[model samples]
Target: MTSAALSVNIWSIPTTTAGTTRFTSKNGHTLDYRIHSGIVGNRWVKDQEAYIVRVGESIYKISWTEPTGTDVSLIVNLGDKLFHGTIFFPRWIMNNPEKTICFQNDHIPLMNSYRDAGPAYPTEVIDEFATITFIRDCGADNDEVINCPASELPADFPANL
Candidate 1:
């Protein structure tokens, strides 16, 4: 699959007022978020944008802001799916460092699970917080997904994405 292979659509809805933005998905999922505009510590804090999207018992929270750059972070709360308690795990950070692209499949079985589930989907949380860097090659038509140690990415990759 391509590096930008996202099943869900990330829609940015305009706020009616100043500090709020509503996000709606194609599956008729709606999340109302409130923005916190103020100053925190030495740096000036901009608006806080967050969305809660639910799929089955999984409630995903995607949040980011202007100061956070172009990287949109996500956290999924698996409610009574695998574990007993409501555990919130950090899934993946998209567009890390503005250039790196990481795609996570959240419907697969755990790597060390004993039970035999069905076919693994992309949304499965195999490795929490796992990411792969995508390098865009101008010569080639498609991009490359690399899962390796932290190294300098190619200059061809888009910056501040």
Candidate 2:
């Protein structure tokens, strides 16, 4: 399979740890993330952005300002199910808690989205978080508090979802 496209954030950057990183969004949003993985070079970048996606817990301090302009953006890829630009996860795999890996045979709804296909659906599954916040700026240089729903990614049948 071809490598998926991911728009890296500024909050998930690693400073001095292997399973740690930080990334900033197109806006000034920032996040601190950490994960457990031995592979270092297995990362992805899209539209001149960068970040790391590991297999363990991570930390982040997210902001809602673009480093260049007043507009900010974030992108994430949910394997073969979704392509999220705001909360991109560069790496993904099919998961099955009961059976080797989770599989979907029908439509499943996730946090921010829903899948009409797949055996089961999945959204943002990250758990280890010291803080989670959302802010939106309407070009006033001021950030307004807002709650953005998470995207949904599901494992489907042999048919492309």
Candidate 2 residues 68-159, lDDT tens each?
Answer: 11122333222222122233121222232212111121212231132122233343223222211212222311112111111121234112
Per-candidate TM equals 0.21, 0.22
- At residue 134, give the lDDT of candidate 1: 24
Residue 108 Cα positional deviation in candidate 1, in Å, after optimal superposition: 39
lDDT of each: 0.25, 0.24
**Residue 93's lDDT in candidate 2:** 21
Per-residue lDDT for 101-138 in model 1, tens only? 11111212331131123122222222223111222222
User: Residue 53 in model 2: shift from native, Å?
Assistant: 22
Model 2, TM vs. native:
0.22
Instruction: Estimate candidate 1's alpha-carbon lDDT, on a 0 to 1 scale.
Output: 0.25
